[model samples]
Target chain A: GEEVAQTPKHLVRGEGQKAKLYCAPIKGHSYVFWYQQVLKNEFKFLISFQNENVFDETGMPKERFSAKCLPNSPCSLEIQATKLEDSAVYFCASSQSTSGGHNEQFFGPGTRLTVL
Target chain B: AQSVSQHNHHVILSEAASLELGCNYSYGGTVNLFWYVQYPGQHLQLLLKYFSGDPLVKGIKGFEAEFIKSKFSFNLRKPSVQWSDTAEYFCAVRAISSGSARQLTFGSGTQLTVLP
Candidate 1:
């Protein structure tokens, strides 16, 4: 695929319920990133991966938020015990290796999550 | 830590009017700057990026941005805007140092409404 792909255009979850989102990076991309877009369109980085390996997790909430990128599978982001603040649009992006300073990320259609 | 600021929350312009969106970041180190646009009901698309070299970078749809290292700003501009250009614009930055996550830090988006 030429573009990053995301599943579940919209997801509704009750408070304290679990929510999961999936993203498939571009065919040749090696870096995948997740971001949360909250009200007022503020984007917050959640996590990033490099070829199925966790490249950075500093932005992820350790308590309830977890993510994984396994070979031959789409990456997943799961949130346990969802709260009102968790309602947001989750965007996934992929980019080629950033070894020599090229870091252009291609984004996917985000999944809008609503926590009731 | 790096943070981006987009001062204009909303901008309204008539067709054929000039456009400019201000973006600033707070980071002392070298950085990569990018501008992304999201039309209604669509995913984000990269408008332009500045990794190194030229301070002024041009993007698709007649969009251009200037990166001012001294001011830590990357302002997007267009000589004229059309109604089809109505969309949300976001400015992002990534630190270019070792041990950095290389994840983008985005600004609160600016909504552009072009009236015909």
Candidate 2:
């Protein structure tokens, strides 16, 4: 029952512009994750949040990329001053962690960001 | 550091043919593995996962993957793949730890093209 929902299925932005992607995690789920797939290469972890608190963000770009999970509102990953290289499919995932079960992360329809 | 390796970048196969996409990891400890699929214009969905117990796991849509511990591999297989199975598949692994840094690491995906 843990499903992630991402808005803005497609986005076109210019160089130096800003792009914001949104994700609504499954209700009652405590963990949210973001990933970027560039040039159809691989899905790289961008950040992870646990109940509005960042658990790990080492894979995230420090300068231009910032993500936040607001209370009630869905989580958002914002990219300021987007470059050509920043164009990719951004995916959001969520997982519900119990005592002893397979903690499988479910993915959402990605936001395809195209920088022209 | 955890890293995943997928043997094929792109595979073209005929309809109703068997499929075996090779996936391997580079970790020495207890790890969790999963296979995810993304259709041409759809969201990424979980195919199967391996955390504990049986090495062979069955997933949705007649897909199955085997988690071989000694080999550090979790290869996905299907007895008969259809044209609808043409999609990009990702292999992911994460250390089953309670640490804050435990995040799923994905490999460069293998794109399966089932020809009709």
Candidate 3:
């Protein structure tokens, strides 16, 4: 069964509008990651969180892109002022530590955003 | 910065044919390699992974990948592929020494279309 869940399978936003994406991590998973796939191919890392704290955000565009994972709430990725280039598929994934030392991340079905 | 490369941008094959996809990475340190598959309209799923020990690792759906340390390559292989296997394949690498341990660098994905 798919553990991770993403809302709004499809979104349409105009340029300069705010676009928000949501993701719910798998139960018991401690890590969350966000990625952007543009042109239906290349995947670019956006950000990652360990629990409610951010672990790494080097890939994020600090200007307009911001993401947050808060307790008792679904993780969210927001683009302040969307541009035509922001139209892409957003994927969320979750992972938890295990005895094997390597825990594989499981992904959500992704949200497709179309900025016009 | 570490990066991954998938040689084939797109691959088309008839059912029952053998399959191979090349993946190379540029990181001069211990790495964790992974092969992920995304079936049409489905979330990304782990096909196989390699951390250490054996150079060859087997995964679900008759998929296998061999990691060659000297060449910095991890190529996916299958003796026979089915039409249901049509999907996008991604190669990802995580450098163990990269301080930000959980960040994954993904390659431009290879889309595999298995014809019936």
Candidate 4:
């Protein structure tokens, strides 16, 4: 695909339920990133992957949030024990690996998750 | 930690009005700057970026931004804005040093409403 793709444009989960989001990077892109947009304005980086390997997980909440990118599958971000504060729009982005990491990241039509 | 600031929370302008949006980042090292626009009910699209070389970069839809290292600012400008140009604008920055993840740090977006 020429553009990054995200699944389940909208997801609704009750409190304590698990919610999962999927993202497929551009066909030739090697890096995938996930960001959470809260309050419709603030974007917080959650994690990133280099191919199928995790490149960075600094922003991820270790206890309840987990992500994976496996070969031949779309990347997944899972949130266990969903809370009202966890409601947000999850955006997926992909970029080609560059020497200096200055490449432009192509974003997907974010998945809006609503936790009640 | 790198942080970005978008001073204008909301801006209203008449059609064909010249526009300027201010963005500043707090980082001392080499950085890559970018501006992204999100039209209503649409996904985010890259407006322009500043990696290296010239500080002035032009993006789609007659938008341009200038990176000022001295002021730690990347201000977006348009000679004339149309009603269709109404959107939310975000400024993002990524540190260009080794060992830094390729995740972008974005600012709180600015809502630009152009009245025709």
Candidate 5:
């Protein structure tokens, strides 16, 4: 069984401030994914990475949101100038590999972000 | 664009009652389906998944799902649910393709509240 870990289970920030979240995927897992769950309770894909390379970021906000998955460091998702709209629970997920057709993902306990 | 639809937003049931959660996807190509459960204040956990196999798939905690290809649906079912089964259920899908990036599209979750 894979276990994904996330840091700072709760975060509170003021509008216009910066917010950063960290995720450590299961050991040996190469695929990392980020998602945002708003008050509406829907999980929205934000970004995904394969190893140290970004695979898909279609759901990411281009101007203020950025994510990275370095080799030795934990994957990070940062939001510059946080807004009320950015207040949501951010979740991290991981999978072993994407080469095969089927890869089941394991999710981490989400980081709850509250922007005042 | 791929999307998942969960028809039921809230379901209340007594112990020993049958449970069914509807999940439908909007993609025509090959895809992988998943059902996840989120207990109160906990992270999302995989309940079951359907990749490629028999149309009927069984998962942990006496949960099962059926993949109806022609209907483009994967519906979760439990013959008898318990109070501990009260949680939020999410349905997700990922397009299966070699060249495309893999990201899960989750549905608007269904909240199950089981009474003892």
Candidate 6:
């Protein structure tokens, strides 16, 4: 089975509207990660969490993007105000390493968001 | 900063031809490496991974890669290519023992277009 899962395979919103995406990490996995792929570029890291505690958010673009990992529910990434530049595919990944060891990260189907 | 690099940005080849995608990383210490493929309209899937043991690792769909510690490289390869093999290939890495080592450092990704 796929290790990570994401919801809302596709989404479209106005420039000023809000958009939210979800991710469910693999069972028993303690680390979750989010990435964004814009247009024809690479997948850029957004944030990462280790057991509900943020481990690193250095790649995250502040000012409108935020994410959270809660117990029993899928982690989420919310954008307050959509921008045309935000139209891209968002990928979520998970790993089982709590100590940041050599665990392989598993990726999800990803959600393609189109901001109009 | 730790990073992954893919030499070939776009590769086009005919069916039955040999395939090789170069990937390199810049990080000191033990690490886990992986090659992922994202087919058109499909999610990213792990093709193969290398942790320890032999440097040459094989992946699904007839893909394989070699881990060169000295050069910090993990390149994907295939003996005979197929049109179905056309997709985006990504190289990712994470240190085996380090803070946030579970987080992946991905490359810009290479677009492989196998012609039939």
Q: State, as a TM-score between 0 and 1, how close model 5 is to the true structure.
A: 0.97
lDDT of 6 at A37: 91
Global lDDT scores for all candidate models: 0.93, 0.90, 0.90, 0.94, 0.93, 0.88
Off by over 4 Å in 5: B99-101
How do these models rank on lDDT, best leading? Answer: 4, 1, 5, 3, 2, 6
Per-residue lDDT over A1-116 for candidate 1, one digit per residue giving the tens place of the 0 to 100 score: 99899999999999999999999999988889999999748789999998889998998998999999999999999999999999999999998875686768899999999999
Which is the leading candidate under DockQ? 4
Model 6 misplaced stretches (Cα beyond 4 Å): A1-3, A98-100, B97-101
lDDT per residue as tens, model 1, B8-49? 999999999999999999999999999999999999999999
Off by over 4 Å in 3: A98-101, B98-101
- Residue-level lDDT of model 5, residues A50-102, one tens digit each, is 99999988999989999999989999999999999999999999988756667
Clashing pairs in 2: none
| DockQ (CA atoms), all models | 0.67, 0.60, 0.57, 0.68, 0.67, 0.58
Runs with alpha carbons beyond 4 Å of true place in candidate 4? B99-101
TM-score of each: 0.97, 0.95, 0.95, 0.98, 0.97, 0.93
Better of 1 and 2 by lDDT: 1
For residues B42-113, what per-residue lDDT tens digits would candidate 3 score against the true structure? 878899999888999999989999999999999999999999999999999988773333777898999999
After aligning candidate 5 to the native by TM-score, how far in Å is the CA of B37 from where it should be? 0.3
Ranking by DockQ: 4, 5, 1, 2, 6, 3
Every model's TM-score on chain B? 0.96, 0.95, 0.96, 0.96, 0.97, 0.95
Number of colliding residue pairs in each model: 0, 0, 0, 0, 0, 0
TM-score on B-chain, cand. 3: 0.96
| lDDT (Cα, tens digit) per residue for candidate 2, span B74-104 | 9999999999999999999988766423678
Fnat, 2 decimals, each candidate: 0.70, 0.63, 0.56, 0.70, 0.70, 0.60
Best by TM-score: 4
- lDDT, model 5, position B59: 97
Give residue A42's error in model 1 in angstroms.
1.2
